[model samples]
Target: MNKKNVTKEKKTRNVIIIKTNRKKRNPTRTYETVSSNHYEMTVAGEAMHVTIERRKGIVNSSLRLSTKGLLVRVPLDLTEKEVQDLFKNYKDWIQSKWQDLLEKKKRQKNNKGMIYYRGKPYQIKVLIEDTIEDKKERIHIDEEAQQLHLQLQSTEKSQWREILKEELRKKGKEAILQRIPELNKGYDYDYNKVTIKDQKTRWGSCSGRKNLNFSWRLILMPPTVMDYVIVHELCHLGEMNHSPMFWYRVSVMMPQYERYRQILREEGTYMARIIDEVELLE
Candidate 1:
């Protein structure tokens, strides 16, 4: 496989591990158990609190059946072994759910790419009708215009989406550097790195290491939205958390901080989903 494909495979594997870890560490406030022959294992999870669900409604009591291990509701009475046996019987089904959950977690982790002015995913296909190419699936870039494009080389082949995503990150950093000073007249902060990512519910994050990450989807939003994200992360250099004092600092920097926060809450999700989606190859 090409490097891009290899990187994508690694990212996919990591996402799966992240989802499984999340489920294991999930803590909630509700717990209930249901019994069903359809269940494969004594799966314990928390919607609110730890609840054991038992699968039911199978034709054969010994026959294990499953679709995906969704948090289902059933009656209580099935033994833990019965659930385990059921899971063993429908391992593929369980795996499918596991994969779905992993994807969902990935989307959530990146905030669905909802708040971007410009950015790309790991892999993206774009048309540059003006350019000529020897091969359909060749890597193409126009340095002067700062444009990168991709095409599907083979109908049956899968390509890494990370290249486009990485490009998006690079562009996003440029955007931050260019806009920070303009947005905050005297904005001065030392940041280790400026990067863009797919976030589920946050516009930006600041790590103790002085690295800043923003949702690339923010590029798709209005300029005001993008400015808000830039200022927010920069402000983190001074305050690491969202304390009242932090908000006051942010307000001093941007008088309309509340307006941007409201816009993000109300419209950010739709924007994030744009980059989170994968278009099928023809």
Candidate 2:
């Protein structure tokens, strides 16, 4: 070969060696689940289930207090002693949150005979009238008396639940329709349509087509909280994503949006649970 050919071959060989060395210096990372175990813990004099899950690629350990119980996620490489130490550091937080959870559960269970309308609680009264036509039920609201009267033609008590839910949906739609235009008066956002839904997990949603959807359970929230949700969805018409600009738009309309957001975060689960129980009633 010529001298030029030899020089080119040497340069190519050096480049190949450099690339191979770089690859060896930085190895790829792979994650795997190591082990999972369940234990019991005492929080505020109550025994609770604690689930510990060890997984790879976790740089930090975290403790989460959920409806079911407490969950701990730890690095797979952490030893039992290290995990226990971490848990001890978060013991106070766990206990405090667990106490709050217990209280919330108790309050949710006690809301059985009450119906929340426009943030006010009303006593529910079911009156069955067999003389009326079959499959006909009417809901009467006595605002001054703070009571909801359901007159059902069917004698089966199970049928009243469905009638009550339907009445709530009608009331929710009427309230939302009235509130949306008042909220949009000063804003530039325009919505195509509004829908009230029986959503399982969401309080409200905005579509790309400018349609808005809200949960019927929104009627159970305080007026401020319900207004915040409406404004939040309206702002979505201007900005679809939850970027800083979208939140700024929401804040422009409702300055106290953060306060209502916190209220929803704190009480949303309990309210949703109550709605689910009502839905499940036969």
Candidate 3:
């Protein structure tokens, strides 16, 4: 075995130990499509689009299963036989991931507008109020009743989405800031600035400059899930990659990290779709 493959092999083994993680997969898929950087292939009765990226260094071939497709990264130095063996060994894992993603897609579709919050089947009503109490100048959420009320003075039909998004951004920032100190208890990781952003794919990220960025979508997840993402990124202040040490830091800070991690892996994609289907009322 090449020294390059050994490096990735070690990482892969550790991933197995962590055992609960990211992305959606499609196993029994066969799409006959071609792109300059990708091609279609079938593995274990499942068809997929695969893209290969070769890199220099102690190059170990690895597979990444995403909602888009599979990516195969390999060492530039590998022989034809080595490359072949890599896929032969990885095929089962790919199929398993594909099935999981397919199921997630189904669940995502079923959830459309089923739960009310600024989206269609438009179940929540707008409660118009006059000279309201100390509620938000614009909107108030009645969580138990799942309603959005508009201060009669605050109705700018074009801005409903913006108003709601800004409120979450403000509240999301305060919520994250409050959790950070308690979660940061002993880690004492030096960090600057916590920002809530509107992001498409990621739940949270830690910057190279030591700032933290969280997706506003996190506001929609369970409170515990939000905390898991916070610790996941905050730990990055000390360890950046998802290496063994990175996961260890996370586990130490939040012992239930694995459970939360699994929850996000299974349901994160669905949550995003719910937010995407919003049809603001006119």
Pick the lDDT winner.
2
Preferred candidate (lDDT higher): 1 or 3:
3
Ranking by TM-score: 2, 3, 1
Candidate 3 residues 1-282, lDDT tens each? 233334324333112111112212435432332222578876545667888666444223467776566776655555667667666766577777776766666655665333333222223344555555555455566766565654443445455556556665666677777888888985989999888777756989998999998886776667788889999998999987899999989889788898888777766656644645655344
- Scored by lDDT, model 3 comes in at 0.63
TM-score of each: 0.43, 0.76, 0.58
- RMSD (CA, angstroms), candidate 2: 13.3
**C-alpha RMSD in Å of predicted model 1 compared with the true structure:** 15.7
By summed lDDT, the worst window of 10 consecutive residues in model 3 runs over 13-22
Model 1 C-alpha lDDT per residue in residues 140-176, reported as the tens digit of each score? 5554554345543343134335544554555656676
Angstrom error at residue 183, model 3? 0.7
Off by over 4 Å in 3: 1-103, 110-123, 130-154, 280-282
| Model 2 TM | 0.76
Off by over 4 Å in 1: 1-170, 278-282
